[model samples]
Target: MKTVLVTGANGFIGRNLVATLSRREDVEVMRIDSKNSLEELAEYALKADFIYHLAGVNRPENTEEFITGNLGYTQYLINILSSNQKKTPILLSSSIQAEQDNPYGSSKRAAEEAVFAYGHNVGVNTFVYRLPNVFGKWSKPNYNSVIATWCHNISREIPIQVNNPDAEVTLVYIDDVIETFIGSMDDPDASYISDYHDISRSFKVKLKDIEACLVSFKSSRHTLVISDLKNDFERFLYSTYLSYLPENDFGYDLEMKHDNRGWLAEFIKTEHSGQVFISRTKPGITRGNHWHHTKVEKFLVIEGEAVVKFRQIEGEETLEYPVNGLSLRVIDIPPGYTHSITNIGTTDVITLFWANELFNPEKPDTYYLEV
Candidate 1:
């Protein structure tokens, strides 16, 4: 079994990494945080087979604390391992800011240098990741990532500011970072670079575009319209946005249309994939005595029994498909065919329907006819 040591275990990336490592039966994890003593850190350093040094300060009150938190702690760990003649592989989570000349950047750069020097002098393997803005579930809102802050505030109906809408920021999803880190453990040599390694998958987006996507997410509940998730950046951003929703606000009421036959409600609507809706029909009730010119649909009876009847617009022959909740089946309603569904059972019949196109009032391709 591999014994892995992780510092800053309570922070965002640290928490996610630790959780992933803990799920493996063959790997043992040793976590050290602010609450742990220096002696504990030294002990873990001595016994660790691999170390993930993720502890660093970016928002310290004083400039001096940056060195103490980022460089000092890293140097201390290296010293402990060096004095004991241990050559454990270490992975340091550095930032893109390390390229700048700011206090935080300087401190992070120093820490990276220290780790590289230790690796060369002591013959230890080192992996340093100069990561971009990382955003995901456990990230702290308003602390570091603007995406996290916007997700939190927008989900709660609070206004967010976009100081420079044209300003662009590069981002890497937390999951990708974790996957890369775990991959390093499995193959340390492959993760090495001359100066520092980088997460392979990253996105560069404008502030205005991000705000627009986030705003659309908040409005989706009422419109029943889902954003295009095929785009990798939007998909990851949407997932991050949902992770900040208030616990009690996870569910929103859907608009249901009531009639003598039963009630129907739209579930999801998409531009490319069309729409999906659910409906219930009372016993002896029939729905959809109509035929479409170009639109197609699929009917699924989830509860009770029903008979779906279809007749070609140009023919006299009628086709029938009997379906029930016990034997779930999908009956495709083809174009140019009049179709109707009758709830033959005693109880109400529940069915799900999917269409190829969104219903348009101006040019409703539907024509009423008897099946």
Candidate 2:
């Protein structure tokens, strides 16, 4: 088994990386955080086949702490490895800020230099990732990532400030970063881009666009409408937004329409794929004596026995499909055919339905007819 050491095990990226590594049967992980003593790090360094140097400070109380946490600690770790004559391959998680002239950037740059020098002098393999704004689950809000802050505040109904709506930020999802980090263990040189290793995928979005997406996510509960997820950036951003929802608020009530026959509630609505809804009908009750001009639907009886009847708009022949919860079958309702479902069982019948388009009041496209 390969022995891997990870610093900052409690941090966002470290937590995700450690979880992934722990699931592998062929790897053993040694985790070190601020709570652990320096002696533990020294001990782990001796047995480590690889090290992920993710421990660093970006929001310190003082400017001097940046050096102590980012640069000084990195140098100390290298010194310990050098003393033992160990040549363990190391991967450092540097930030894009390293190119700037701020104190945090200077400290990160110094740490990168230290790792490169160790690799050069000791002939050990090294990988440095100058990551952009990383966002996903477990990331701290208002600390390092603006995405995290927006997700947290928007999910909780707290007001968020947008100083510059046109300002753009580049982002890399946590999963992508983790995948790139794991890939480095097998072949570090393959991911080299110019001077450092980087995640293959990144998204550049304007502040206004991000705010709009988050607002839409919040409004989805009321509208039952899901935004287009085929776009990679929106998909990733939506996942990140959900990760910040309050624990108790994970579920929301759906609007149900009640009538003498039964109750029906829409579940999900999408722009391209259409909508899905569930319904319940009392025994001896029949629903849907109508035909659509262009819309189509699918019905699956999930809880009781039912018979779905369909008839062509101009034909006298009627087709019947008997379905039950135990059998688990789906019946497609074609356009230009009048259809109806009758619950024959003693108990209420539960069915799931999918439609090709959202129900429109102005242009229902539905004509009442007997089936």
Q: Report the C-alpha lDDT of model 1 over 90-144, residue by residue, as the tens digit.
A: 9999999999999999999999999999998887678999999999998999898
| Each candidate: RMSD | 1.2, 1.5
Would you list the clashing residue pairs of candidate 2? none
The runs of at least 3 residues in candidate 1 whose Cα sits more than 4 Å from the true structure, single-residue gaps closed, are: 188-194
Model 2 Cα lDDT, one tens digit per residue, 1-371: 99999999999999999999999998999999999988998999889999999999988889999999999999989999999899888899999999999999999999999998898888878899999999999999988789999999999999999999999999999999999899889773543322588798999999999999999999999998888787988998999999999999999999899999999999999888889999999999999999999999999999999999999999999999999999999999999999999999999999999999999999999999999
Off by over 4 Å in 2: 188-194
Query: How high is the CA lDDT of each candidate model?
Result: 0.94, 0.93
Instruction: Give the distance in Å from residue 211's predicted Cα in candidate 1 to where it truly belongs.
Output: 0.9
Instruction: Estimate the overall C-alpha local distance difference test score of candidate 2.
Output: 0.93
